[model samples]
Target chain A: MQEELFTSGRNIPNIDPYLDVWHWPIALYLFLGGLAAGILFFAALFYILGKDEVYPGAVKKATVIPPIALSVGLLALIYDLTHPLYAWQLYTTFRIESPMSWGAWVLLIVTPIAFLWTFSYYREAFGGIESKLKLFNKLKFLNTFEAWVIKNRMNMAYALIPLSLILGVYTGILLSAFNARPLWNNAILGPLFLVSGLSTGAAAIIIMSKSMKEKHLFGKIDLGLIIVELALIAHMIMGYYAGSQVQLEAVELLVGGEFTLIFFGVVVLLGLLLPAFLEVGEIMGIKIPVIIPALLVIIGGLVFRFVMVEAGQLTRYLY
Target chain B: MRYAMVIDTKKCVGCSDCVVACQTENNVPEGFCRDWITEVVSGSYPNLELELRSERCNHCEEAPCVRCCPTGASHVVEGGIVLVNASECIGCGACIASCPYDARFQHPDGHVDKCTFCHHRLKKGQLPACVSVCPTKCMYFGDLDDPNSEVSQLLKDRKYKTLAPEAGTKPHVFYLI
Candidate 1:
């Protein structure tokens, strides 16, 4: 036996120290990015699908807000990095195999497209002469030349949907890659993140539109989207409970373990349930302000990230 | 070549001599460790058997930490030892998140840190600090490719195992139960 290779010796004592120094900034970044991605993707979907009738002024307003929110989200992501200056390296040195590498590329691609789409809307708001310049005029295509660009670029944008879905889902898949920590290791994490991204994105757009007082033509569509979000969340929770015993124990950590209260009370109830109830109320002829549910849903989305990121880290790998 | 460490749990006495030796040799930061041990006690108190495992970067052939690093700061060296360039590390903690074994830590200088299998010592034809100071001689280090090397011989002769073989990391570190 290989055990014969060594002579006997004394044992060492163990120390299990908690390393919880990081907070806020990391959590904030995850929340902001999820919101930004969610909002931008939804807006693009509405514009491409010609679903304007379902949510009148929503696409226009949504197109304007996502770029700014995305810029803020990008800043938050850079801020959370240990070395923010090296962020440029993500663009310069790209690796197709790594998800971080892929995310960096996706951000690079999405950021400019989002900005151009947003700028197209303000070309008229900001004045016309400047909009005539080649660059500005090209950007104005999204608003003025929508038919030509969409006819030519529609396939390109359609290609972006799957890519965008990958970008949204990559965040959760990143966490699940750590197989040692049973809590984060699940095949379902990818879909869960994708759904959550859509939910958070819709919530962000709803909140922004209400705040700006842009005509809430999209209220019914927003309500419909939120209802879909609720269904996805329910599926995720049920899957979390019925999966592997080891994973179920890990889920217990979120449902009632160390993170139980926050996960159930803040994320599940306030974040998801309250927002869901508000949407239902709107559908049933009650006028619960849309902002109230939007805020709650956004908070819930942030809390979901907090719980997943922290809880995944907290669980130990027992071999 | 894939460099690896074979640990015989039966021979380990749970003494932390390897831990301290590794720290001093590497000049690891305060309150942070590149290598440590975990003890899992099973069964009732009266019949409990203490299992001790020394943990460190597995120097996986398909290392996830290196893949996750945004700056190319964390990477696998020539010998398959996963090394981090402290100067380049932004301490983004992404590598820390990627490691399945939880073998990484953030240094005070705001860089990701972990065991490098004592790269400097290896270059000088010496054993790693942990392997050199292991009092019970529980740790064995060598090139996995060389059939005559101590590690390869051990693999050939013993029914050894590795942590999370299902992870497909092809970790260089192995255990002899």
Candidate 2:
């Protein structure tokens, strides 16, 4: 029998795994990106599918989210990078195999399109607010572009739907492409994130909707998206359980190990199930406060991304 | 030519000489390492067996870090040694997440760092710092394509194993029992 070469005692230290490369900046970026994508997707879809009169100001308010959320998310992403000043390197070339490359291109394309889409709501953006300021008279050149935007607004909104969907899916794929982390490597992550994005997007719209019917429409859609998100969560766990030893370890980390409390207690109970219950109660003609479920859904969506991004890194194949 | 490494686990003393040598040679930042020793203990308490194994980047042919790199910073250079271009690295940590071995770490200066198989030494016709500094002569490095190379000769004679063969990354580093 050989003696222990280096016992974990006073002499030798145990090396902990390096699993915290990503932090809140990343989590915020993931949440905001998905939120922005979802908002634009539904706004464009509503513009194309439903009667314009049914939701007069819904699309315009929703359009506001993508530009603000995405710009902030991009800032968060850039700030999180080790080389914030050298971020231009990501745009210099495209690697079809790299998800980050796809993400960079998607963001670049979406930024201009989102800015254009915002112009479609020129009346909403600069309606009476612009005229009150002396600067509006100085910038009379904006009137021509605003008219053109209003004329082709429908066509522009239609073009935004697919781009929004791509952005939502790209957020998930960014993590999924890391095959080393089993928790983030599942193929279902793409749709799971897309559905979560839609749910949060719907919740955002519901919070800002002017009409009862518009609120109800987005509320019902959010409920459906929440159901799919929950189903995907279950599928993701089951798949991990039935997967390789490394994958099973990942599930253990989430289900019973370090991340157990947060994953189950916060993400599932507080974030998902509670909002779902409230949504169900509202559907059943109960006087459930719309803000309650809407807030819960948004909180849940953010927590879900936080837990996954942080806990997923804790599950390593080499440890 | 495909570069390779062969480490005889039986001969390792777990003194961390290779670790210190690599750090000194590569100037690896404090509190981080490009290579380290893992102590594996097995058998019942009364019939215990202990082994010390040196671990580092396997530099796989199907390197996931290289694949997941957005800017092609992590690349395979001459003799299949995996190296990183610190200037091009965005420090996004994508490579850090994609590395199955956990061999990569985020350098405080902001780029992902890992074992490079000592390309600088190889260019100078010298062994890697870890290989040259091992007191037990357990670590061997050379091109596997040359039949006369020590690495190929060792592989020809020893019945060996690899860490996480199921990973399917086809790592170039081999272990001799």
Candidate 3:
């Protein structure tokens, strides 16, 4: 085994054997974008479904936050790049084989779509010229046109739902491409990210909606989404446990290694459980307001990102 | 043309002469280094084996630092030497994070900095500072494309390997275990 290891022609002279260097930035981009994509996906879904009645004013008010978060998230990603100004080159020189390149394109497309969807909705409610015309203007020549053929505000927003979901899942899949990093190289990461994104996005929307007094629209959705998120978290944990020993050790690092405190305390208990408990209380006719739990969930979600990004890098790849 | 380095671990004495030479040759700032040596000590006190790797920019053919750079400051030179255009850098630390080997640093001036393989010296037909100063003759640098070059001959005659070849960076540096 020792001879094979040395004779494999895989060692670098005077260079420490380490995992791929691009892992840190790529991981960070995946985490932040996944969260943003997850939030936007849910927001767009609820809006297009006309389920705003369940959450009331909250959904409408909270709609603005996703784009803002996504934009900020993108900035952080670009900030991680050595040459941030060359970010636009991703579109110009697209590489089909590179997941980062794919992510760049997805972010580019989703960012604009999300912005337009939010803007159109805002214009409609606030009585902007474009919004008023869109809402009230009649096209005499286009009366015979099929309703589905014409682009409408709600239709535009509906278009974003699938794209946003892809963006969310793409984050996970991006990391999975790194077969070198045993911790990150898993088929389950994609779905795990998808589920986590939904939960985190829903939590962010709920909290932001409360601050904006759009609680009517945000309240019920928050509870439902939180419950769904908890289930997903459970499944992810179970899946992580059932994988290879290397993966299991990686999971243990999250659950019991250096990252245990943040993972268990902040992510699991405070982020997932407390919010879930609050949602249960609300559903059961208890008077417990969700603001506290919502805040905790958000903090937990962010900490979860921090922990995942940092912990994944801590372990040295032995193979 | 692909230029490369081959370092034999057996001859390295864990002395940091190469590190000092690289720093001095480049006028590298205090508290920041373009190249350094990392010592890995395994086993207990008595039976420990010390492995020393002199690390710098790998000047990878598919360098991620160049790909992730937002400013075009990080790039590959003619001889496949990865370099940073310090003047064009904005100190964003993107390269630092993107580098798998942690080879880059954001200098005090907020520019991305890393080993250039001493382009100026290479242009004048001289070896890199670290390669020229190694007392044990552990480090060798030459053009890989030229079969007559020392590095090419060594690569063909002996077993050598690169770090993280799976990354597809295609680093020019090789290690003889």
lDDT of 2 at A26: 89
TM-score for all models, in order of appearance: 0.82, 0.93, 0.71
Question: Candidate 2's residue-wise lDDT over A119-200, tens digit each?
Answer: 6675564577656765546888777877877788677677777888888998899998887888898988888888998898
Q: What lDDT does candidate 1 reach at residue B55?
A: 74
Model with the higher lDDT, candidate 1 or 3:
1
What DockQ does every candidate get? 0.31, 0.49, 0.09
Q: What are the TM values for chain B, all candidates?
A: 0.95, 0.97, 0.92
| DockQ, 0 to 1 scale, candidate 1 | 0.31
lDDT of 1 by residue, A1-319 (tens): 0111111121211113423423556566556656666766666677688764455344555666556766777776777776666566666576655667777787788777666655555544344645566465466644556454445444545655766677777777766666655677776777667767677777666765633333243345555656666676666667767765556777778766888799879987898777777777776778777878777877887888888877776664443
Candidate 3 is graded, for docking, as incorrect
- Which residue ranges in model 1 land beyond 4 Å of their true spot? A1-22, A49-56, A123-163, A207-217, A241-245, B166-168
Docking class of 2: medium
lDDT of 2 at A249: 84
Q: Better model by lDDT, 1 or 2?
A: 2
Best by lDDT: 2
